[model samples]
Target: MKLSFLIKSLAGAATMVAMAGPALAAAQSAPSPVTLKGDVMLEKIVTENGVSKTQLVEPKVVIPGDHLLFTTRYHNDGAQAVTNFVVTNPLPSAVALASESAPGTEVSIDGGKTWGQLGSLKVTGTDGASRSATAADVTHVRWTIPTIAPGASGEVQYHGIVR
Candidate 1:
């Protein structure tokens, strides 16, 4: 799908995923207990002067099969540690998960309701037979951070392919 179409369709969403980094977290609430934010990055294989190189750039125009990595960075700024901090990021239909990602991350094929390892998820096929979920079938990715210490920060990432 074209980027313009996605912007037009998702613009109606009430909660937009604004890019909020650690600076934004610290400014408000005088140190957030747990602040999570997401960012999108585009990577493509470019051949220049007969040398192929992979480049990461701001998402603009992406073609089918282009690789991408979606990442969410979380920070803990409260006076105490936070346990079970979770971050959930939705995958745009424009991209298909192309690889197994973050070790502790869970994938959802049924939107965001239920999630598990891709191999462990079962979905009914068009013919009404259950089958193992494929990476391309992922709809969302979630991670459960065991614990985050005060003023600590970390990031989780997932791989995807433009489709």
Candidate 2:
């Protein structure tokens, strides 16, 4: 299946905002101090000179079980520092989160309505039963950046597998 659609959907759904205080909230009409960019890549293993290396390449198409990497890059464009910056990315229904997320990353299994560590979250099935959420159950991934200095840029990433 072509994964470009999934990637595009994810990029559009990803959000980055500064968790400002009431005073700053009043200035919401003003330009944001932080800018965000999102991308998705397909993971591939290539062999050269009898050595194998994993590479992240732009995703064109993907098959079930293919590994994908999702990343969000943030930059502080304002003159002052930005505090309590949060970045959140919603996963596409075609993908299932794979392995452990980055350290300090919080996950949401309920469509971003609630957030917590994967181990601490729960999911309700159609059968009216609740089960501990797993990586595959993650609907969103987030990272809380305490501070981002002027002109500073950084990125956060997570892994997923095509469903």
Candidate 3:
């Protein structure tokens, strides 16, 4: 009898709490509003040597149909060191990549700005001329990495089909 009474009391308490306040109702209906406010101000430091460079470190060119294994290396010359950086390469309009490497690096089909994975980039029409990236499209190019460690270097290479 005592156990049964305890359970009933708990259930009654729960129902009362549920109906007791707007906070509970709001939490159940939708997540409670959240406000986050903070700021970290740091003086910007500019150094002559703080420069980032991306270059084709290896073989510049390859045969038209051959796999042009071009490796691009990025260097961080900044004293403070940079982190969580992404490296990208845009494929020129005239040329397309080989079958094994049709999708080029960071080549946003939508334009030449945003980049994503190869499979995500859409080729609407293969009619070469008709097949083009438009503003409505969200074509992404292959990014070297999702993130790069500070003061570190990374490389990415891909083949292209010479037009």
lDDT of each: 0.82, 0.87, 0.48
Candidate 2 has what TM-score? 0.75
State the lDDT of candidate 3 residue by residue for 81-101, as single tens digits: 454455445554434544454
Candidate 2, 51-132: lDDT as tens digits? 9988999899889999999888999999999999988889999998886563456999889999998888878899989998
Best-to-worst order by TM-score is 2, 1, 3
Looking at model 1, how many pairs of residues clash? 0
| lDDT for 21 (candidate 1) | 54
Candidate 1, run of 10 with poorest lDDT: 12-21
Best candidate per lDDT, number?
2
Candidate order by lDDT, decreasing, is: 2, 1, 3
Better of 2 and 3 by TM-score: 2
Can you write out model 1's per-residue Cα lDDT over 121-154, one digit (the tens) per residue? 8989999999987888889998888999989999
TM per prediction: 0.71, 0.75, 0.41
Assess the local accuracy of residue 7 in candidate 2 as a C-alpha lDDT between 0 and 100: 85
Q: Which predicted model would earn the best TM-score?
A: 2
Worst 10 residues of 3 by lDDT: 34-43
